[model samples]
Target: MPTSTSTSTSTSTSTALLRLRRQLLSTAYGNMDFRYQLLASLADRALAELDRHSSPEAEELADSHLRPEYIGITEGRALSEAGSLGIDTSGWEERRERIRSYTRGADAVTPDGTPADSAQRLWASLFDNYPSVAAALADLLTGLPPSWRMDLFQTNDLTQVPAEPRQQGDNGPETAPYSSTDWEDCAACMEANDLCRFHSGFLAGEQHLRGLLATLATDSIALEQLQDRNHEIGQRQARESAEKSPERETSQ
Candidate 1:
């Protein structure tokens, strides 16, 4: 026989869990969008670099920048870039079409039987491809409130049992547990998480591009110096041969 108080507590927990699930879903989707924009900005910058100083090495770097293993992450940005560059994009189009068909099909779970939620899929795709980004997201998770973390674990079936309800006191309804200050702390943590993820992702992309550009610039400079040195040596050899030709004529 469950008391009304216990029943009410269970109901409250259920409601909180539902709210938290929605929040998680929303956050995951938002993060996916944020990552896509970051990648797209990087792709655009690479393309601009190619347009300004087109070289085989630069083009290859741009290709690598645009071509991530997870096609959905870029959403045809690579295909569009390939077409603009007059490269064959038929293979990419075909792959995208196949994915579209599969998404439209009746499969509700992944090959491993995990539920195929779009937000979760995109989140996993990004994190799996970008370890730094994964670290940033993990930091965000670490910043969550302990109670919220526990709720998340329970929601995901990671916990074997529900958390025990706080003991009621002589006072009424336990004063609602979470204070306004706690909520402000959660909000602050979320803000910090966003900033951390953005900065980390930006720095990663910038470093990759800068390193590629530097290497290409160095190679170009080295080639030019070699060509100049070879030209100077050829001229010296020609002048020496001309001087010896006059001496040979006089001897004859």
Candidate 2:
């Protein structure tokens, strides 16, 4: 038998969870600007939650669970992780630093003392520098997994899967050294790989947050149970003390 208050709280939590899920799904398939906006929003939400439930244990859980993913998305660690998978992420750190400058307000002033690039301009710059970002995202829906791609992307025709990796000295122009198409393909694949890593980190953080929320919810219940047990022990001890006092009075 749940109280009205408890039911309301549960409904509120469910609503928040649904909203977070929708944000994550949109971020997954969104354009660069939309993705960046949602990521920033989600990060702020996580920080707000931490502030709302401030505790040493909560801070520790956030550091262990949420911080890594947040850093990965904001600081280009996802690209670095992809690099560890043998993907070439050359200049990724530099590009990430450029984005960071805008985020940190370092790029907020121009030479003429005018306000610098807006969010849209910054995103446009990123798009120009990394033309394959959108393509890589599209690849995720239309290239990687075959059966679900069509249903998800709503295309009657299947996208042609990329050919197998080329071996050195293979009898094809694609195997030629310094092929521009090869470079583009590599860039697209790396970007896609980075995105996948980012999504994995996001999911991991979400799981941690869910666990932390559950623990916070139970903390008051556990405290109430302990208090009740202690009260019962105190009452029992008082009864025993009174019973013994009567005997002492008779002896006296």
Per-residue lDDT, model 2, residue 115, is 19
Task: Give lDDT tens digits, candidate 2, residues 67-152.
Answer: 34553464456766787899877877686665454234423422222212233333343454545764565566466565674665
- Runs in model 2 lying further than 4 Å from the true structure: 1-19, 25-76, 94-252
Q: How well does model 1 score by local distance difference test?
A: 0.47
- Summed backbone clashes in each candidate are 0, 0
For candidate 2, the per-residue lDDT at 239 reads 96
Structural RMSD, model 2: 24.3
Model 1 bad stretches (over 4 Å) = 1-34, 40-81, 104-252
lDDT of each: 0.47, 0.47
Cα lDDT of candidate 2 equals 0.47
Clashing pairs in 2: none
